[model samples]
Target: MGSAVLVLAIGVWLVQDGVRTELPPRPSSAQSFPAAAAPADDGRQRATKPSIPGMGASPPIRIRIRAILVDAPVIPLTLDAEGHLEPPPPDDNNLVGWYEGGVAPGQNGTAVMAGHVDNKRGLSVFYGLGSLRPGAEVEIERKDRTTAVFSIDAVEEYPKDRYPSDKVYGETSRPELRLITCGGRFSKETGYQSNVVAYAHLTRAKSA
Candidate 1:
């Protein structure tokens, strides 16, 4: 299906309907790129183990990206009356929103999570997401107390008008995850013009 068709199927409309007037001012270059310590490993050790059977459907409670030192709580999100996936409340910049009705992280399908790149106050939880490289780790702690580990496969940006919904929300045989945030040039009149999406697949899972 095309981007438009997939938009409705996968709840991409909410992203397009952002309230431009509510956006905060952009951060300076220095504020946007804080230096982070390197991770001990490249987030690939989990790739060596096999995923637990039938363990991919648990609700995710938190997400951590060690490379950028991001550890944030996750809240469940649902579609609104307009058929759009609800975004995290604008007041909570540190929280990420997971599509509760969709595939859970580590499930055998694409799981979706989104966060604010920044808020009116300053940088948000995913402010550094654009800096993540391939092989970086994205660990999702689920309600089951088990952790689903994923290895970054790619990071991409697309104009909001040309979002590749099929690729972002497409079905997959292996457990996969998609992290999204607003990106690209910010416009005072239009807000952010692009969306950043990080693609990754479940490499392994560890019990609490």
Candidate 2:
């Protein structure tokens, strides 16, 4: 996904009572947001191991982030008629949505995934997303019976109005993954004040 074609509009679901007991953590002060002109070093040590080669396109079936105890099913998400990306059904709080229009996870491009931070009931699938730190692992299981393992590089939150679409949705030479959800402040009228994004690149790939 490129900046021009990126049309995601996430974190719109309202939480119960218009408030949440716990908000996801922000990126450590040492990390810096990627630059719009070019990707910047997030101040984290790059993995010593070389990145795995990209794979053929396959729909992701599941996503796991052991550091945050996330293990959820992955569903395909599409752009609505209005060009905005549609979120997963609110009825299933544990589900994650993948942008089907983009390259699938493990492919030679940035893959995007999203989930609700919380629903009317409470915390949802990506409630702990912002808490993840550099070096953490994110595993995506694909229909082809393989798992793409990624290592986190940075996590940051941006106000909705100022979202860096080019940085977050930019094309990449190697396989990369992005996980997103609502973050920052909340209110009855505005839902979430910002969106949290975790950037990572494929470190390993294995058979199921």
Candidate 3:
């Protein structure tokens, strides 16, 4: 197989949250959001405002995991024609993308975040994702400046052919997060053979 086929296969392998499909074209400029603005002095930024999932749904702006020393911005991603959730732009190795159609990080369902393990150059945003263990904390900063704290439940890997999509993207009683990246042996013909998933649930929410 050619390099393009390898890259595309790896991209699809990294995303198992939505309907399986091929990768989409590069997102248009309109898909990108502006830089988050600083909070005003009046303390308005301290408020936790809810959006779509009603009570506590705010779009995540950044993600932090102190144990792994990961501090990365979050981008919203949409599915392509075949319903596959797009990965973060390959050129920006430090960013992660959240599946916009799914439950937000602070809402009452699983919120999926996917990132590349590495590109042709080197390590990517989620290169350390699988190293995270149970009890470690994953903090997601929302546009409202409130941080939704999640406690890692487990780190699991599954073969690409047997991906547990229903469990990974299934409904939950409380807010939860799933961090996904490529793992296992890599082959020029088939890409990574497994996916590394980090499972966590909300433990607390506070003003940033």
Candidate 4:
């Protein structure tokens, strides 16, 4: 097995509370955020604010991935053992294998959602994630009924240990999204050896 994770130091958000995380080192420095600027001489320190991801002046409502619309649910976020994130389950796959965070979809940064490719059975949600083409679209629906659409810009796979940390999870200058699922082979000795990452970028967003 490759001891090298692409950039794993990986951080994934779980809730509005911003479930804290440590992401792997990034493959690209362009995605890296600078450390908080030094505080001024005043007693007050510099308040480093994280930019809202995906929900800026213009928010996305629908995304298209693998030619499917990720329609927004009346309530996109859910919790019950499975974790929370932007794109929740597809109303199937009965298992503790989902994201539990709020789902307005953070802006500017990468609003992430995750699922399991398989449990003990075999072939679960996101099992086809590797099949997503670069141009596939992912749609996210909103409260107003409008849809925000994005296109798959790239897809990269990484070994568990070598997953790039900074690039995948770091803050971005542009709004982006990440869909994650387990990939590669598993080992009784270890675990899943790789992670499948689908990278998508906004193309069209509407506020129906």
Please state every model's RMSD to the true fold in angstroms.
7.6, 3.2, 13.8, 11.4
Clash counts per candidate, in order, are 0, 0, 0, 55
User: By lDDT, who's the top model here?
Assistant: 2
What's the lDDT for candidate 3? 0.66
Q: Show the lowest summed lDDT stretch of 10 residues, model 2.
A: 37-46
Candidate 4, 70-125: lDDT as tens digits: 33222233432433233333334322221223223434545555654544444444
What is the C-alpha local distance difference test score of candidate 1? 0.68
- lDDT, candidate 3, 1-208, per-residue tens: 1223223443575533322122212222222222341111112311331112323778999999998778999999876675555667777768888877777888887788888777655667777777776678898999988888887766776677777666566555567778878776566666667777777767788895
Tell me the spans in candidate 2 whose CA falls farther than 4 Å from its real position.
2-8, 11-19, 31-50
Q: Model 1, poorest ten-residue lDDT window?
A: 32-41
Candidate 4 or 2, higher lDDT? 2
> Whole-model Cα lDDT per candidate?
0.68, 0.77, 0.66, 0.45
What is the C-alpha lDDT profile of model 1 across 53-90, one tens digit per residue? 43646899999999877899999987667666667876
Best by TM-score: 2
Could you tell me the lDDT of residue 155 within candidate 2? Answer: 87
